[model samples]
Target chain A: MSFFGPGHGACPGCGLTIATRNVLEALEGKCFVSNSTGCLEIVSSQYERSAWGVPYIHSLFENAAAVAAGIELALKALKRTDEGKVVVFAGDGATADIGIGPLSGMLDRNHDVIYICLDNEAYQNTGNQQSGLTPTGSNTTTMPAGELMPGKTGRKKDMISIAVGHGIPYVATATVAFYADLRRKVKKAAEIEGAKYIQIHTPCVTGWGIDGKQTLESARLAFETALYPIIEYENGELTKVRKIKDRKPVEEYLRIQRRFRHLFKHPKGQEIIRILQKIADDNAAKFNLDV
Target chain B: MKKVVRGFYSIAHSVKLCKPNVIAAYPITPQTEIVENLAKMYSNGELGDCEYVTAESEFGAASILVGASAAGARTFTATCSQGLVLMSEVLLNAAGMRLPIVIVNTNRALSAPLSIWNDHQDSMLLRDGGLIQIHVETNQEAHDMVPLAFKVAENPRVMLPFMVNMDGFKLTHAYEPVDLLDQEIVDSFLPPYEPPVYMTTKNPLTFGSYAPPHCYAEFRVTLQNAMMRALDEIEKAYKDWAEITGRYWGGHAVGEYTDDAELVVVSMGSLTGMVRDVVNEMRREGKKVGLLKLRTFRPFPVKEVRNALKNANKILVFERAVSFGYEGPVGIEVKSAIFGFTPEFYSFAVGLGGRDVPREEIVKIIGDVYEGKVEQGFHFGTIKEFEEVVV
Candidate 1:
């Protein structure tokens, strides 16, 4: 039985909705989900079916982390601390912008909970607003690129690095692209005694301006190109790199989406591609993926 | 016995007496001194058996309090200006989830113009944020409001956040002699928090829900009903405080200063002291003027304001902050408090951003309202007749 529930209302190719179902399925109803206000919140929690068979709480866009901390405490107060898991789920916008305070606080306090940031890379709920997670050379509604240059200027925040920086018990990177790995990591987090962090590479098809069927394809391409490398830390030490396959050139990942079309628009097109290549190379070295 | 302390320290002194189990806070201007002092006390062993959270931001501070309180700890937090805005999200979570978190905000104007001093804008903005709002007139009231805030907030019927505001600079920086309550008495009177359900993994539960529309609408109604029922809780809290301190917070929303007279000047915050003196001076000169100092801003004590104000023919509302497009915020709220009874009021916005409002100006405002010269309203210390804009 699906622990998150039946008839999930996620859009046809919504990676997050699928990822959430996978998460709950892995936890097997021994979890309390704290969701932040975002696209996932509206779709799954709107009118009728909750889509969540397990208990869930939705706090403000900025406070899901804090509420999750409260849930962990609730379990302790109830004297069932060992029997269940506490989970905080949010979009990139909430995790990076509004919910950062509580998230950081949770990590600092080393509260026993798994904070899963579903990085679809843009503020998909507010009409594709550019968020802190938006990769460079991508067109968000806020940072729409045209003939002159590529899209978003900055690179995606190294959230896994940031999480590790907080010295939490576990910090890992996984994706809906790798369901088995995702479930394994989630279960491991639930078993840990303190704060755990996971960055799930869930792509927003509509926001990314890609065909719905390309959801998983793009997710796989992302990891293959080193654009989304999967790494893990234990006891605050960088320990593992999930060596799955060889690297694909970064341009192959960018070519599929119109949002990244600006990167190939002009004389500076090759320059943008070069920058993207450098990003992938950088991730490869930092995460020690080449070994 | 008298002890001199800054408004912030005075608040801290009382908080120490209350003996909170958790002091969760991050620093922000004006109000930071309170939390900083508490942290010092917690570390130096001046306070015992407490967890002092050195948090990341105001939001985190509020959240830490929630977590600590859920773990059956008495908690508190202090913030101001943008910190208040940042805590906006946590504030609602604290109230809606029925967490009795005590929040102290030093009144500071919100950003755009970026003045970091006295203004009611920050506290006024959260007037409808499902928290009990108490504005203080002096260090004594600021010191007193905390215990009452805790009692009112902890009453299960009103398990929401409560803001005890002490105006920045005017109160936060000003030093005054305050008679602190004894710790033994406080411990005996204000019992420690023991929640019915604490946050634990042992027996898990969720707060806040991914509520569908059917459930969402009902929750809002429940919040409304709960807030309405808090009036009784506030009274009971007051009664409890009175039994201990012998202070009468029984005036409902509006505190009186010769309120039986024909002319009443309505005001809030520390400005009440100036208005009180002006009204009494006006009364001595055979002028039928009085003052209504509002201590409670939220749940707007509608009944006492109307009953006490019914005898007045002319009412003058003095607000320390503007509402941008509308009339003075306090003036608008005051008129709404006595709406149907129809007390003719001249609303004024004055002394925003720490600009002083002298007693003479208050007397002039009272005279203007009495003589019906304030056609729209008045703005203290302006080039021309700065009346409250009626939109």
Candidate 2:
């Protein structure tokens, strides 16, 4: 299963590399993939032997979805649209930020493909810069640790909800922590008609300033604290939610990562904790997350 | 073979003949009637096996057409000035991807002060886009242009999509009878579009990949070469189409009605019809004059133009749009096209922003150019207050 062994160009505990390698491991068929120009592409595709085990291509940041859409149509003309799942491997910088129009168009037009958004918060490939998915109170290079206010101005955008609104048949949320769930979600998405979107939370080690080995735990914390609630919408409606065994307070989640260390500047940490709680509460109200 | 029809209906009827598998268009004035007729044509089984998406916006209409075209379907869409500008990005994407999509552009004036009238600004603005642009004059020409456009665009050697342009309100709403071609002939002439690749997860090929600076530059140059190849492909299509209809309405790839004369006038789009009338009047008067009607602008048939103007002493260019702060765009291009070769060129930048250019003005232009009264370079169709310039 671990075709990408220890010797890799990625950072010691780069969650994205692990997640992408693990993500491709489930493919039993020869699939064509479009990779967005980001950290995943830069590290994995160094010159000759791209870490990609399958046929992987790359395009511009904004046109990732459009490129994949083209490949999908090409397969259909050849009567091979169903042979393998055409997927786009892009990050938050490419997905929610730039490639939204093409992605939304593909979903609406019902292109037969799967698009995976490997969310590592900020634009990690460009050196710990803020992105649309970067949450509030998280200090990055742009949103510096300051005394007056927090790191990111607003909360992370509701991407999964927007994807659902596009009326794609399958839309889900997963994390690198839950390998089994991530694989299952991707597989399920590929086996359907029309475009599918899956958002995976892979904590960036350098950006998050956390222990490399603690990547999985950080992913788990995102879910347990409900800071990054995992939910799915099928055919434009709420259909599934991943069950969290023991929900923890948002403080326990934020206090672990150095990115969120700014919130701990005050001992009480009451306001930032409530803000995280409000995010979770809003999501719960919005999607009615039972699990 | 002729039937009485409105300009817009001519376009709609011609679209029906091609039988586009997907017709994604939203109605906008000066161009709405055609799609309205098409939406009906698609719905009534007259145009069979087509997906007619009544899009929410011009942007959606454009994107939908791109998706449908990429999905290996022969697609059609119609838009005017604002709509065309709104769909600008997808238009570039469509041509860049070599989609071979044939779209109808009802040429309308771009708005800021919000004026919707006949102008070539819309199509002229897209002259640099990698697509064959054919301007049609009459309703019959509009009808005839569609079939040939599809054939040229989908040519394997020149897989550049084409946009057939007609003056908006001037032509789109003007009802005129056209000798519509038999659908069987159109079907036989225009074979179904089969793109080299389409959207599929299986056997995915790289499309729209960022070629590192070196490859990127080469790709652009190659695209330019393909556009050049389309000239021959379009001529070939015209040759084949002529056999069926016994009419080569494409006339000259770069039109020249009476080229072997003292002076030559140039025009494109419905304006050509006006030029033709003026030329006929001048011919009867024993005045040795000719008219060069530009049909295909993208390939910019410089060689043909030079040859047509070879015998002529004075060559006048009547442009419908201005480049602002410069001479007319068409005049500039025509001048650049014939750069090294010297000709007594008079660029009459006229009929801009829906301003009317009467036939008398056209006659006066020929008279002035011949008399050595007109400026040697660009003129804004200005007339001496001695008289109002006629067409």
Candidate 3:
């Protein structure tokens, strides 16, 4: 009983496609979804055709959380709370950049909503622009690897910690590579009574210049290298972490993607690679990701 | 039923009587009292089954209303000036989606060298944003326009967003005698909002879909047709409310006083009150002067405006907002409405940025226009002499 139907216009091996399907399937049609302006919304809900089998709305780029909050309050006000949960799907740019203010307001209001940030790391829909979630040493159209500069010069914003700082009832991180784990988080978020936020590491094949079939492989490498931690929090307390049995090096994750291919050729490439490794090391230490 | 109250309190009471399901608004000066009063009502349990949300920004407030309205709830919010500008994107989206939401805009000047005072520049900036815009003259009219706005907006034939514009500090802060509508009468006038289609799990629906170039213009045409249809809905709402309360603000759109008058003053918002007084005083002196209060700004009331001013020899179109390089917005629309009817039309930008439109100023502008002392084009009504500044 999946709500996200097929025949949509997502690119081949689109990670958002897999994450959207997994989240909707976990909800089992007992949710109303609002989408921000992004690849998922444009592809799934073009006029005269919609891929959503559940009630859906796409208002604007930055107001999905606020809109979902309105939906939650409306259902409560209309005495239709038993109908379904209210969920929002926004891209990383929508979540961390243009939409952060409204998202924080929604969480601050503690509306009964599940906000899912489809973190493809960059604005993949708009041809791979640099987003707040774009990691360091990643090449994007806006932040290209020129002679003087390496790749992106900043680290990915720690959005999970920001969500936790809002003191919501539930906050978690998942990856599209791990469908079962992502589904479990969705179900748990649905069961929570207050605001819930989940940031999914949905790797972008086009943006990362990876092969179409390597979307899931890239997602797996992201988590396995400890660069994208899979962790959960309940009531602002860390409750779960996906520990790695044999943690891979960050070089293995960076080498396959063309976004980081420039890092190996540039004179200052090794230093940036070392910086990326230290980020992964910090995440592993912070989340206790070792078996 | 008559009580003296601030304009914001009157608007708040009117909205409460209409029984909105969701009220999400952020506080802005002059517009803050309306939501604050509503919040107080909600806290006091006067607003039954209503969800009151204090949004972080006007964008959030307008977006919440859009979501609630899409979910089949009667929703509302209020904003002005910069706040209205912030909510511009979501407001257009709501109109495109044909969501029947009512917004009360306490008109204020736009910023740079910021002024929170009364002006129509805010609402005028969104003149073509696909929302039904109606201006009010006094606090009493502002109170009456809320339920009427909701009725017209929720009319299945209309199903468009409505914006009721009232001057910021002029009407919002001023106390006036208002005859509040009884809840029973309001409930009978505006039935429960039953949208044709809405977001529900039992029956899924998609809203705000992406339109290709092949069909985008058609959707916009549909919205334009909805605005055109709103004219009739506004008339019907006005008729029904007048039937219940016996208070008619105007006929269709323009409230006219052109009884065989040659010079007719055309204006909207609270400035109309001062113009009305000036016209009455001039009429007592046997001068051929009259006033046309523009109630509905959007859907321009073209037919009514042309009909009302066709007999006049001189038409003075006064407005509080300018269109920058062009003339006053209302003045441009008026000239366009009666293009062929050459009646020596004069455009005047007056009372801008909270400057007071005194009765003397109104009389002086009319006198200047009638005497042919001012040009036929746009003219600033009152400009103070410049003072030396030691910058």
Give lDDT tens digits, candidate 1, residues B115-215.
88888888878877888888888998888788888877787767777888889889998989887777876776678766766544344444555575568
RMSD of 1: 4.5
Cα lDDT, model 2, residue A217 = 92
Worst 10 residues of 1 chain B by lDDT: B198-207
Report the number of the highest-TM-score candidate: 3
For candidate 3, what is the DockQ? 0.90
Error of 3 at A279 (Å): 0.5
lDDT of 2: 0.76
How should the candidates be ordered by TM-score, best one leading? 3, 2, 1
Mark the regions of model 2 whose C-alpha exceeds 4 Å error after superposition.
A1-116, A122-131, A140-149, A163-170, A190-197, A204-215, A234-239, A249-274, A281-291, B55-57, B64-71, B197-202, B250-260, B381-391
TM-score attained by model 3: 0.98
Share of reference contacts found in each model: 0.29, 0.09, 0.82
- TM-score per candidate, in order? 0.84, 0.84, 0.98
The 10 consecutive residues of candidate 3 chain B with the worst lDDT sum are B250-259
> Candidate 1: fnat, from 0 to 1?
0.29
Q: Tens digit of lDDT per residue, candidate 1, span A72-130?
A: 65455444566568788899999987677778888988888899999999999887889
Candidate with better DockQ, 2 vs 3: 3
